[model samples]
Target: MTFVVVQNSNNDTMTRRELHQAWGTQKEKLKLKFAALTDTDLLYPEGMETEMISKLALKLGKTKEEVYQIIKAI
Candidate 1:
């Protein structure tokens, strides 16, 4: 599952489908927001989220946590 973010004080969270239901929007926003990002960088194959984030962190010169926060915020 593609985890989006933690929801609230209740500690509930949602996956890509359950939450935004519009990863396309967020993906577009992400590419626009970070010009360095490419479509390949956003690719999320099954069970590859960590690798994807690691790649993003390396490309953007940010920590994984920062990358996660950026994604979550979008």
Candidate 2:
């Protein structure tokens, strides 16, 4: 699948669409990456990327950047 990359205010390069797409395609891998994460945790509400990051950060004990990197890697 194709992805569009965008730079955020902090100059972090992330693929917003691809992040969600990868979450769909790589759910099992992500669960392995963050054992504490659940299926509900992966759900992405529209325009709730920050909320998703916060949830993941809390669940995974990771920084937002780290979570973003993990998602980007997927």
Task: Report lDDT (CA) for all predictions.
Answer: 0.71, 0.73
Off by over 4 Å in 2: 1-10
Candidate 2 global lDDT: 0.73
**Residue 53 displacement (Å), model 2:** 0.6
- The number of clashing residue pairs in each candidate reads 0, 0
Clashes of 2: 0
> Residue 55 CA error for candidate 1 (Å)?
0.6
Q: How do the residues 1-74 of candidate 1 rate in per-residue lDDT, one tens digit apiece? A: 54665343345445645434556687899899999889988876645556777898999999877777777778
CA lDDT, candidate 2, residue 61: 87
Error of 2 at 7 (Å): 4.3
